[model samples]
Every structure is written in structure tokens, then in C-alpha cells.
Target: MSISLSIHGAAHTVTGSCYLLQSGRTRFLIDCGMFQGSKTLKALNYGDFPFKPEEIDFVLLTHAHIDHSGLIPKLVKHGFAGPIYATHGTIDLLSCMLPDSAHIQEMEVSQLNRRNVRRGRPEVTPIYTVQDAESALRAFSPVTYDEWIEPAEGVRARFWNAGHILGSASIEIELTTGLDSPRLMRLLFSGDIGPEVTSFHPVPESPQGLDYVICESTYGARERPQMTLASRRDLLAAEANDALKDNGVLIIPSFAVERTQELLSDLLALAKERRIPRAPIFLDSPLAIRATEVFMDHADELEDGEAFRHAMRSPLLRTTESAQESRMIERIDGSHIIVAASGMCDAGRIRHHLKNHLWRANATVLMVGYQAEGSLGRILQNGTRAVRIQGDEVKVRARIRTLDIFSGHADGTALTQWIEDRGPVSRGIILVHGEEEGLTALHDRLAKKGLDGDRIFAPELDAVFDLLAESPSKRERPAPRRLQPEVVGQLDWHNDLSRLWLDIEEELEKAADDKARRVVLRRIRRALENERS
Candidate 1:
């Protein structure tokens, strides 16, 4: 019997990575990630799994990024009980990140319910709770890199450092039939491969001898400009000098994982060399601080392990763990740098920081990571004059800047080089976790390398291709009804209108007299009437 693979998620987008593999009686999954990006994409998170969760044997998690591992709690909550295998570094990071993800879900649900209660709408529970996340954690089985193990019957797998994050890895699986059969298959999954190298980690080694390859093309259409560690420090110093010109707050909205730690190292290096002033630096996200500790625990996996450990203890750095402490940061006077989480500014304490300082001309929000399409960070990056945060309209007067040196994913050129180094594949390549443009560009490059057009497959959402078949055939199955993008957009607009109406209601309630209330209500009515007309 031949092993068959199904492309479940991350086929035409950059998030929600999941794949189903089947071999005779055994079935397994890889990367049960949460969908992210525009509201249309995020709705996929609440949809049913393509395959029954309870039927899968186990999950092979690539890394701990929410885009890659956020749905583990939801998976476990849906009745999955098998082991979730990952690298040692990934396991430690998950220990902190999963609970934080659960907390965010609970808080979001609570906030929504508060509004629902006032609006007479039914309250909705979170997709998964903290207990669910904790339960998922119990199923994790940590394995070191370069070691092979049998996660399921008749299958062997190994993890190779992807250099994307602290414990990120590219997985290799070898499947064989019965002892009497001579057929065997080797499959490789590139789980968000990192760049050539970062300040914290060395370049990832390419895996060889692959029968088939499932790869990511997140940055496949463009190449990153060359930047060295020294240049990266210089760029940070320049941004700091510009932002701190008049004792201003320099806010860096970073991801809680590798990005935050990398920024800390660069900032500390700059301060130590006197290239930048020794400003008060606050690590504001509780999740990021916890992940930083995990980085410390696995310092040996980093490039300059000793330097990373020392930088975490720098006098210029302080961590804010509690809500009270986070609020206390606003009381801090003078030039200071605050690094917070939810890099996209979609959630977390970064919104609080943005709300407080975004209106100040002297403040600056330095973006050091990729911001998804509908994220607040992207809106700011696009130079929006105003944004609604926590139902309050916040002006955007703060200086906004971005430095690409901090990105963990490889560029198009780097990805091409890595693929070239990985040698030839006997079967074919399936490109996932990228947009259409990137996928097309990468596919063209692969075609030039002798891969035929028919062999390079880029499936759409829910589209499946059987790997073990004689030729690629679109699976014929009953398609489930999914909300159309237009419908999703309409729903999003409704939510926005509801929030605006609530803001108006609150304003009217605060009015001092009947006349004032009448004026506010009239304005709201007029605005709605004008919109209709």
C-alpha cells in the first residue's frame, strides 16, 4: 500500500498550516495551525477540521508560532488524543504560548459577551479554554533534532533545524509497506524555513534524498536586501535616535517568539557600544517575557548563546508582567523603548501602548515584523489617520517605521538557494503557505529547474491532491458549505457598525442634559440617514 497525503490548509495562504497523511490503517497530521489574516481567513479557525481529529494518530508540529501551532488546543478540544511531536525547543515555547493563546481567547470572548449582554445578543463562549490548552500540552512529545523515531506504525521521522525560530524544524518522514513489499517512500516537509542565518541562530542545513517535498513560499516572490548584524544594530540605533529626539516613547510591536529576543540582543548591543543611549527598555508583553525565558533555557541552540543570556539580564531591560505594571509604564517619564507582543497589533498589550502614545508627535512605533492584511499595524503602516482600538478612536500622529532586518522567514532568493541545495526530488513539489504571486513566481523558478508545470501543484482552500496516485487527480467529494468572502466582509462591516453604535450610545449616556443627549442622538440618526440616502 502507498502512503497518500492530503493538502488541507496553507495551500494558497500564508497561515493555517495543516496536512493529513494516510498509510493503510494508520493516519497522522502535520501542523494543525490556526488561520490568520483578513477576517475572511480567520473565520476558517472556527470551521470543522477537514478530517476527523479523533481519527488521526498524531500531529507533527513544525514550530510554536501561533500560525503553526495555535489550533492545537482546538484540536485537542475536538477529541484528538494522540501525541503532538515537536522539537525540545518547540515544546518549551509551547508551554508558555498555548496558555497565553487560551487567555487571549477567553478575554476576547469575555469582552464580546459584555457587549452582547447590553445589546441583547446571546453570549458566545471561546473556541477553547485555558484548560483545553493545558490538556493539549500534556500530549506533546519532545524530540531532539537529527534523531529519528517512529511516531506511528510503519513510519519513521526525524527533525532538522529550520533556523526559523529557536526550535523550528523541517520534518522528514520515511514510510514503508509490509516486509514482503519492496516499495518505500521518503517525504520532506519544510516547516517555514528561516533565512540563511540570524544573529541568534546559524543557517539551516538542507535535507536531502526526498521522494516528495512539501514546502512553504511565504517570501517566494521577493528577495530581502542583504543586511549584516552590524548594519542591523546601526539601523536600530538610527531609529532610536530619531524616535528619542525629544524624550519620546519608542514602541516596537514584535512577535513574542524569536523576533522579540533578536530585537533585545540588537538593542543591548547598541546600548553597550554607546551607539544608542541607555534608555529604559520595557519588555511589555507577559507572553514575550515568558518566551524569552524559554530562549534562555535553550541558549545553546542560538549562535551567541552566552551573549544572549547576558543580554537578557541587561540593566537597561525590565519586564512588565502584570496589568498594573503594564499600566505603570505610562507613568514612566523620559526617553524609553517598549517592546510588546502580537506583532500585528491585532491583539495583546501592544494595542494599549499604541492607544496611549500613537497620538503623540514625539512617539514612534517601529515595526520589526510582517503585519497581516487587516491588522492594525498594517493600517498604521499604510498611514491611516485614525484607528479604532478597544472601541476608542485613536489618532495616528506617532512616527511609523519598519526595519526588515528582524524578519525570520527566508527571502525568495534564499528559498531558491535552499531548494537548489536540497538536490533533486523523485516525485514532485507542493507549494503551500504563500500567496498566489509568490507561489507563481516560485513555481516558475522550479519549472526552470526541470520540474514540469503539471508536477508543481498549488491547491486552493480545501482542494486535495493524492500523493500516492499514478497522477494528480482532484478528489471528488461532497463539498461543505463555507461562508463566501463577500458574506464574511458583510459580517465584518456589521461588527464595525455595531461598535460605532455602541460608542454613540455610550457618548449619549454621558451627556449632562436631555438637550445634549438629543443632540448626540440626532447626529447619529442624521449620519445613518445620510448613509442610506
Candidate 2:
């Protein structure tokens, strides 16, 4: 009659959001997200799941964002045959997203293996393949928002509009226990709550008064100014106007899903209104193009459906589907905009565009989404003078700008309000999907609002808890973790090695003569020899 919850991913970090819930003989997962960010974190993607995939009864997906649903294909590949329940919109998005994610992995691993061959290292395989992703698709069972369904014995669940993205939802789960008495345990998983004022969808809504609630805190520590859609577009127009004023190219590193669609709609609307000069805005990622089509197909469900459809169909919006066409964009001249994927600039065509344009002083890189710690986008935002891109060092002469107004997640204030609105939580609040600062800030804010500090639980990765207990109690881990919890969100040695290389080059360039450079090299060699000794 007891239930347990395990934090498999997204404990003290913003990506890789998975949770394990077990009640009696029934077992299921809330999400099977892929790990993103630091190498130490991403390494988990290639490792075995903490629990047996075959033992899992089913999965409840929050949305189609890679960080929330990317690893489902891997789960299926690993023998998980259970159905993955998601909203219709989420299913549609994943039909394209999962395959695209697999393709990226295959492509990246192929290139990595080529380099490994050159260096005599063992080749590595991708975590999953396109075929595996398609297989995962076949397992999806779509549910409509606000509808309740039973996926297992003693478990009935409902999906509510999260307002985060197309078909995004906050899941409400009811577990019935004590067969004779029929006691019910209620829980709500707030899957990435969206902001109040957004271009699409109304404010995030959910049922109030629950036994327990697990929430996301991606923007828990940061509060942004409240902006209407018009004001938000005005800001974008200003940035675009300034970036293109000197006939400069504007490169936007965008997420291929909701983020890209939102930007495309606004950009086209601005152009149509003559707020910003009309220029060919190239959608460079094939994944993004496909997602845009999904958005168009589901426009009737959105807030400004007609406007969005109009914006999406604009002639100024050009989609480059072929690799040749993508490469050809580099040969173009003048003040056009390039919207490419891998929003954090960690992968995808955005890196290629960055390598080609980052050295140009007139080019501008506009970041319109969250950039995790140690991501290339964050590094650029930190004002690094140079960065290595695809084995080539590129000077960062281009203007780097961030517009936080476009974030899908609610800000600190909005998140706090959302949590408050889901009030009268009888058991406790479990915070996940955030870094240390965010988790702490949200915890403190909740405390200030008169909630008991002890009731707010911020569990680390792989930490298990007894959900039926009077208070959240941690359980001993069954096995050692792939990486220490301390190493999850912070920069790892891989990042350090990159920085070390950059530093050495900087020092060598600063040397007055060859003799001085030789002296520096000799000192480094001596240090290495000492370490070996």
C-alpha cells in the first residue's frame, strides 16, 4: 500500500527530467528525458538506466522537449515495451523530434568515430538510431487534455494544459490504495509551467488541492519583467533593427520546437507590420521546419491561431531542408536572419553558422532561450574572446545578445505564483528540473510565503523517497551513480581542457619572442613530468 518516488534525473540540474514511481507491483516513469549540458551529465545517456527498462509498466510524458522526452527511444531500444502516454500535440511533435534527435546522435557519433579512428581510440555508437526512434513512436498512446485514463491497476491519471508548448501538460495522478477502504493518494506533476503572457495558449491551469505536487523550477531564481506579446515583439524588433542596421547578418540559435515556431511567427508579424525591415529569414534546421509544420497543423488550438497561421505562411520565411541549401546560406550577402537549431549552440547547424559568422564583427548572435551551464551559448554570453568550434578556433567578434522574454518556462515570480495557485498541498512539494541556485531560490521564496521549509524537498539525482511517509525520507541507493551529484551541473574536465588549450594559445601569442614561448612550453613540460613522477 506504500508508494515510492525516485529522482533518476533533473535533480540539481535543468535537463534530463525522469522520475520513477512505484506503488505495490505497479511501476512507471514520469519522463525518460535525455541528459544535456556538461559531458559528465550527458555521459549518463549512454549508460544503463538505474532501473530495468523492461520492468517499467508505462511512461507519462509531459511534453516533447528533448530534455523531457528524448530518452524514450533509448528506453524502447532497451526492451521497454510499455505504452508511453502523452497528449496528442506532444505525440505529433515527438513524431518528428525523436527521429531528429536520433539522427543528430547518429551523425555526431559518426563524426566522433572518424576522429577516434584517426587517434586509435575505440569507436562509439550512438545512444539510439532513427529506427529506434520510429519504433518508440509506435508505442505512443495519445490522450486529450483534461481527460482522465487508467494506465495501470490502482492508477488513474489526467492531463491539464501546461501552456508551455504545443500539447504540453501538467499531469494529475490518483493512486488508489487499501482495497477494502479504498483510500486515494493524489499527486500532480507540474511539467514545465509556462508564463502567463505568451504568444500562444492561455495561462497554465491545473487542479488545486493535492496530496503532493512535483514541480519544475527552471527559472526559479530569475524574475523577468512582465511583457505583453506586443511589447515582447517590440523588443525583438529593436534588436533586429540594430543588428541589421550595418547590413549585418543576425544569427539566432533557436530550439527547433516551440521556440523556433514562436520566433518565426513574431519575426514574420514584425516584418509584415514594417516594424523591422523585410529580409529573408532562413529556417536552417530541417527539424525546425518540420516542427513549424506541426505548429501550423495545430494552429486552431492556439490563442492567436489566425495570426500564427498568417505569420507561418509568410513568403519571407524560407526553409532550407537540404544540406546543400544549408551550406549555400553562408555564401549569401547582406542583412538577412538565420535561425538555426541546437539553441544552446551545443550542436546542429547553428554551430556551423557560428563558425562561419562568429568572426565577422558585424554579425550578431541573438540567444532566445535558456542556455545551460557550460553550453557554448552560455560561454558566448559570458563574453569569451575565442571558442573552438568543430576542431577550429573561432574568434568571437560577433555581437552576442540574449532576450529572456522568449523563454517558455515561467520566471521566478510566475513560478512562485503558479505553485501558490496549486495550493493546499497536504503532503509536500518536491522540486526538480533546476540547478542549485534556482532550487534554493525557489525554496527560500516558498518559505517566505509561509510554507514550511521542511515540506519542500529538493532531492538529488538517483535519490529515492518514501512518498507515503508523513515526511519525505530518503532511501539508500541500490547502486553507485555514473557521476557524483556535485559534478552534475558544473563544468567538467572536458571544458577545462578546452579552456586550457585556449589559454596556452593566448600565452604563446602574448610571448615577446620565440625564446619566451619556448620557456613557457618548457615550464609546462616540466610540470607534466613532475606529475608523472
* Candidate with best TM-score: 2
Runs of candidate 2 exceeding 4 Å displacement: 179-181, 473-479
lDDT of 2 by residue, 330-443 (tens): 888778999999999999999999999999999999999999987899889989999999998888999999999889999888888888988999889999999999999999
lDDT of 2 at 422: 89
lDDT of 2 at 306: 84
TM-score of 1: 0.90
Which residue pairs in candidate 1 have backbone atoms (N, alpha carbon, C) closer than 3 angstroms, thus clashing? 200-303
Q: RMSD in angstroms, all models? A: 4.2, 1.3
Q: Candidate 1, residues 1-533: lDDT per residue as tens digits?
A: 64667766776678788888888788998898887666667777877887899998999999999999999999999989899999989999999999999999899889989999999999988878999999999999989889999987688999998989989999998888544655778888999988764887778865786878888988888777788887778888999999987898899999999999999998988988888889989999999999999989988878989899998889999999999999999999899999998898988999999999999999999999877656677778888766778878776899999887888989888877777777677777788888777889988887787767676777666654555666644432223434432332122553456346656756877899999999998987899899999
Provide the TM-score for each candidate, comma-separated: 0.90, 0.98
**Clashes in model 2: which pairs?**
none
Candidate 2's TM-score: 0.98
Looking at candidate 2, the ten consecutive residues that score lowest on lDDT are 471-480
Error of 1 at 2 (Å): 5.5
